[model samples]
Target: MLRTTVARLTVRGLLGSRRGLLLLVVPGLLLLMSVIARGSSADKQQLTATILGQLGLGTLVPLLGVVVGTGVISTEIDDGSIVYLLAKPLPRWQIITTKLIVAVLTSWVVAAVPTLLAGLVLYGTKDALAVGYAVGVLVASTAYSSVFLLLGVVTRNAVVAGLAYALIWESVVGNFVEGARTLSVQQWGLAVARAVAPHGGISTNVGLGAAVPLLVLVTVGAGWLAAVRLAGLTLAAGD
Candidate 1:
């Protein structure tokens, strides 16, 4: 069972902050765009792909994952409050796992739900476009939460590093460099989306064969490493 205490603390830390309100911005914009795009004469498939693929999956999920994932642990670490939790006799992995659960659920609720709702409004499930992208967001959110959670454990600048990876690496380099695309979480997510959507509806650079294993590796590996790191965390001496 998940540690209810840790989970509750994480939930409060994430949802009860200004950053939590910031998380609403992208999803809100996505829904607003979906409503406006519905009345335009533009092609439905293209609009869905552009909004859901580029903005929703590419931008929103990762941004929220960084905010929520880093917020869950980094804030505690920064304020020296995590030492109290670590001083307990509890297993380290349990704490990491509990925080991971909260981060994934928060990202899924904020990002994936909006994507699904927007997809429905934009295309009304005509080609399963919304469902497909929702799956992509789910997969991407898990990986992002794991990776950013590890970053939170190991670094004080988790948000900056997460932003660099999401914007510079994933957005800029992944698009321009063929090899970089193979390693991108967004590309892996697109591969999953490609499988669910109608033929030619979704596009992906990496095949499902590669995407699945990479996703599993990144998500599991990052979480495991974070648990190990937390096991060795030291508290500074009180002056």
Candidate 2:
């Protein structure tokens, strides 16, 4: 069935192709930043917090999620190859689910692991910061992957939209707009960090109670919508 095919394809594309190389770039950058941060005799706490919050959580995680998530479907759609599967008896939801799983896992490995390593390099188990950020990255990775994958399925402009959400909305506006902070994924991940971090080490614009529900809602709701949209997905002929 399409599900099996999708699973096979997802694994192969994620692990075997040149596309897998893209997943390495963010984590590699994280490592590089960690080294540079260590050399400055910076305030270890502030440096750790800045790297984890500003770069790791804010930039790298979302960028990896967008790349992996959209790569799962967008490449195929662009080449008109999705029709090979869509034209068959396979249900489109299967493809969406398999791709979602692959994208989420890829995002976690590339974004989350490097975050923990960077945390360790910067702070070394201090205040459980590494563990906290790792958890937040996983949480944010799931939601981001779902949203971007949906964008990939539905729009040729998926990367642009994903970048806008990650950079402009989450990074730029979330910093200034108090209400927007409540709705942002960065804030949601920070909420998870607030829960896991030692005492006051981590804080978030959105409270633990509100953030937990919003994270669940956004991640699950977006995933569900992605499956539904994939089922009804359409592909037009050559441009």
Candidate 3:
């Protein structure tokens, strides 16, 4: 029941709307950059790392997650339409789970698939960089989608906040500050890559054991919090 409605809303928000175009744009840009870089005198190892670490996971994954995750509920909340659904006989957790599932799947497709292809184009299976980064993107996408989706439910400036977290915290601070790296999803995913990648190819500040726990905790915690938030969600009236 609630799951069905949330599923309908999630799919519609993903594929049956203008926002779908934005989803298309991110992956298209990744592939385009991969193609253009193929023309240059780029070192395949550096190129693959840059694209996967910086562009694919660092930029596109979070961006798409913010868009798709927030699109599932924030738009409805913004328009005061969620009330109709909330008024029904449905548990809030069901809605949250359904939307979260949609967000996770969408994020994987837009972020992870292109990462593999870009990795292939750049590295050509060298040192297993392609597969490693692909797996990293997949794992990171799940965690990111949950975090951003929770943000969507709890904040009006979800996109702004998500971007700040993705670009400023993860990209800027994670690189400059060693401590920040341990707390970053980018680093955690990189840890996963490090475990699977050929020796000395992929590396992260956080180890695989720590990263796996953090990923699961953040994802599940955010999702549970979102369910609680949704249960008591209130709409602001336009004055």
| Candidate whose lDDT is highest | 1
Instruction: In candidate 3, list every pair of residues with a backbone clash.
Output: none
lDDT of 1 by residue, 3-81 (tens): 8988998999988998788778878988999999999899889989988988778777778888988999999988989
Give per-model TM-scores. Answer: 0.95, 0.91, 0.93
Per-residue CA lDDT of candidate 3, range 30-93, in tens? 8899888987786767777888887787777877877887888888877878888777777778
lDDT of 2 by residue, 212-239 (tens): 8988898778778877776666434321
Report the CA-based lDDT of candidate 2 relative to the real structure: 0.81
The full ranking of all candidates by lDDT, starting with the best, is: 1, 3, 2
Q: Where does candidate 2 have its weakest 10-residue lDDT segment?
A: 230-239
Could you report the Cα RMSD, in angstroms, for every candidate shown? 1.9, 2.5, 2.4
What lDDT does the true structure give each of the candidates? 0.88, 0.81, 0.83
TM-score of 1: 0.95
Going through the candidates in the order shown, the clash numbers are 0, 0, 0
